[model samples]
Target chain A: MNEKNTISVATMKRLPLYLSYLQSLSPDAPVNISATSIAAALKLNEVQVRKDLALVSSGGRPKIGYKTVELIADLESCIGSEVLHEAVLVGTGNLGKALLNYNDFGRYGVHIAIAFDQNPENIGNCVNGKEILPCEQMPQVCAQRGIRLGIISVPQGAAQAVCDEMVKSGITAIWNFAHVKLIVPPGVVVLDEHIGTSLPWLVGHLS
Target chain B: MNEKNTISVATMKRLPLYLSYLQSLSPDAPVNISATSIAAALKLNEVQVRKDLALVSSGGRPKIGYKTVELIADLESCIGSEVLHEAVLVGTGNLGKALLNYNDFGRYGVHIAIAFDQNPENIGNCVNGKEILPCEQMPQVCAQRGIRLGIISVPQGAAQAVCDEMVKSGITAIWNFAHVKLIVPPGVVVLDEHIGTSLPWLVGHLS
Candidate 1:
């Protein structure tokens, strides 16, 4: 089986942004959107947009723009949302709780299967009907649920220890929210959510 | 004084990650850390790290490595947190509320000056001691409080309108969380908190 269709992550990242901008346009009717238009919406270069679309195997005509609906659906299939992704979010703090309450994940075919914490006071309770289990049971619960995605929202102090345990329990990808950087072995994927980086742009543009 | 230093937004984004890893070592530190070590922490290429650091007018020495404390201090200074930044968060929904309660902003000198919402019920409220004002009073409140930075967490439908109002009210930079890519003019900077572009590393590492 040829994997030339296997899109790069950078291109995959652009898919959602494209879909989002396309969503603003006609959903039922296919509208041809130029690479320059998409690029302008995304603050990206026009050539970069064309290159990304080409890599995704999208249909684009000369002089005319790409069909919005077809491009969106093609990009969606390219990224593989065919399988429902069950994820477990650890650390039920402000950030974690906010994520649980966020309604958009279902549209992406990803759902928070469970939430856990170290505090016994939180154990046996439920937030958004997802059981809040003890941190000790993470391995058991993760295995039982067949969870592959892990979202870490623990404080900096406990983040590394939790990540090590998560990796051991078979989590392949982690959306890390802790301020600390987790050191994981090769083949494990860690998504570091650094909120501070979003600060400078805000400062530079505003000041 | 002639300014001799300039850094790209991409490099600035990774500084926090490097600094935090250095902080993990604390007073007892490694004599030198290779680009590979930095790459491991960020799930990026060592070549990328070397290229980025090289642009900052400093290179890691062969024998002693980059001085940990000095490197961290330089990264901080490069980010320019000499004075605390004052930002007002508009539309205190789940995201804005989450940010208001976030405790980690102090290290970066980012302080939430105030929070505003369109709903009348949210007005006259206080989040983290910062008053929640009506959207109409933004211009006056922001000017009086010297707020140039703005965070937009409104619904997708209201994002552009809110941003226009913010810019009119004298906001300089906007950290957008509307799940939509904004088209801001050249003078203004718009950084999306969208996970599509935000979690690029996970897709590559996991694939």
Candidate 2:
């Protein structure tokens, strides 16, 4: 089967920014908004904003600009929010707990079905109402659920092992939060969510 | 002063990946390796690897490739790790605590000298030995310390107020983790670290 329409990764990253800003505005505040307004508010280029918005189904009017409510819905579909994703997280450390408590995930259609940890003290506990199961049960539970996305929040030493387990358990895509570079086999997608990279990128601009 | 040598943000993001990969390899293991080997290992293009490595001071030999040790140090300098940046973090929530405990920051020359929170119970607490102070003291302490980098890990509602306090106290750059797009007056750099964006980007690829 053919895949859905594609957007560049750079453009995909900016969609959430536009979505959140649109969500912040009152439905009564403006019937339509020009790309120029969004560009000014978000410090983005006007042409880029228009290009990104054009990827959505609904097009902007010549003078009235994009319809506010319709744009939000288009963005939601563009981001695949219509299809709720139930995934598993394999770490209950501080970052894992932070990801659990992060409320924004719900808006984006991601729900952590369960979290796994090796710590005996944390195994029986709960984070944001999601059970923290033993690492041994990860493969069984994730496979039984047919989960597709796996989040690796483990330490650098344990990240690869956890990723292998996730892939072995039927996870097709992995969102890695570990510091090290993971080696995943072919056909599996890995998104390295390295927060440290932002520092250098920001510093480069600051310099 | 003239700004240090420049590289594109895309190239800057990949430097850490190469650095970490190089750090994993033993210098004695390979006297010389070509960009093709590095590209194959990381699933990146050979030309891109060569292009990125060229930005560093040291040059690669025709067939021997770059000296691993020199490349590592050059990558360190490329990312500005040689200059340790002392910054402050506000919001000692789960995410804030995660940031404090993240050991990778030290390797990147980012030290969260202090963290601030409004929670009375957490004000006197500590994470990774760094004191968590009241928000009221942020301006004073940051001003006295001459802090230039501020990290806002607070909730959406409180992010702007925390950012304002940081700016008022002389913070010139901000690493914001809040879900909102902040309005910073000109001169202050804000890097919004949104984990949610990754989800859509990943989904876009998966679909």
Candidate 3:
């Protein structure tokens, strides 16, 4: 907590990876682990891992290193993993449904509070225990729930409009899966998950 | 393709974004575009955009900038967007089905030729016109088709096992959606899409 605001985005992203790896360790595994061990396991640089861990946890001793349980608790607290951050998803297509059914988001403290779509047929359906509402209800529902995160899974053409609505509803963070580059106002954070780009990057590497 | 081998991973990743943006432009829009214009649109550095574009295309003029149509073709060829790269996806779960149903991959020249799952109920099912086959047939199908790219959407526990099978079946590149850091040989490439990390990063930034 000492350097919470000072943690770089790169380190912040790696915190989840470290937490997931530590959580994946067996119950019978060693209680104490060195940064070198973690870095080796995750195929990361040892010095970088040490620096990243130091920002979150102060339990690293000279030789004994960090206690697994304490490090996990510190990471969880620092990354806000213990807090339930609610988000509203717009677009109830296959990708939206997959995001709804994705249980891992809960582990990272993200819960898709509701989903919305303009299609009348999709509006009355239930996906992964959450009912789909009409697109008209998005702003009201998000504002009522005090949700700060808005997920845009709609097509490229509708993404900007959906994002504008979310911003108007006071959502500060947007996770955009649409292919287009979203234009957001200042102070609004948008994480564009261009899933299409990953494939080409991989293919281009192979060729 | 003059500096194809010298292109950095960062530039390779950005090529698709640039291509997508260029393709999104209206037909009546300007036929020429400068890196400064692109930088403004995507909120990137002008120098970085120019350097990235220069690596892919030689059509950029000093003042008039690059012609839209020719630049698009050069970007496409550089990113290998014209070649149909066939891939096999493992796991027929919600995420797998979503990827199978995702049509944008075709725009990026990636085709999910087939899918596999261990669940007997899903084995014979068809998702987005691609049939889900039994897990046992994975190696034979991948080998016979000379599949170099493999997608891992299976659960974390089963990921490494499936990755090993894919490597044994002649797959050299893996687009892993599972939350595990896979261990591959020297020549193989693995792109781990850690979708879970994005949410926490967004929440952390907002907090």
Top lDDT hit: 3
Per-residue alpha-carbon lDDT of candidate 1 for residues B28-133, written as tens digits (9 for 90 to 100): 6576666667786666778878776555437478655576666666666655566788888888876788899996676666888889898998888987787898
Candidate 2 chain B: worst-modelled 10 consecutive residues by lDDT: B1-10
TM-score of chain A of each: 0.86, 0.88, 0.89
Superpose all Cα atoms of candidate 3 onto the true structure and report the RMSD in Å to 1 decimal: 2.1
Count of steric clashes across candidates, in order: 4, 0, 0
Q: Which ten residues in a row have the lowest lDDT in candidate 3 chain B?
A: B1-10
How do all the candidates rank in terms of DockQ, highest first? 3, 2, 1
lDDT of 3 at B48: 99
**Any runs in candidate 1 off by more than 4 Å, and if so which?**
A1-6, A26-31, A41-43, A204-207, B1-5, B26-44, B55-62, B196-207
> Model 1 chain B, poorest ten-residue lDDT window?
B1-10
Q: What digit string (tens of lDDT, one per residue) describes model 3 on residues A1-207?
A: 654446766687788778889999999998998899999998888999999999889999988999999999998887766678899999988889999998778766789989989999998899989889997887788778889898999988899999999999889999999977788999898987867575666776667
Ranking according to lDDT, highest score first:
3, 2, 1
Clashing pairs in 1: A205-B172, A205-B173, A206-B172, A206-B173
Determine which window of 10 residues in candidate 3 chain A has minimal summed lDDT.
A1-10
A1-207: candidate 2 lDDT, tens digit per residue = 112236666777788789888888875787888888988888898899988888774558887788888888888777766676788998898899999877667665678889999999999998889999998897789778877888999988799899989888888888999876778888888888878776875655544
> What is the fnat value (0 to 1) for candidate 1?
0.42
Give me the chain B TM-score of candidate 3: 0.91
Using TM-score as the measure, the top candidate is 3
Q: Model 2: runs farther than 4 Å from truth?
A: A1-5, A26-28, A204-207, B1-5, B204-207
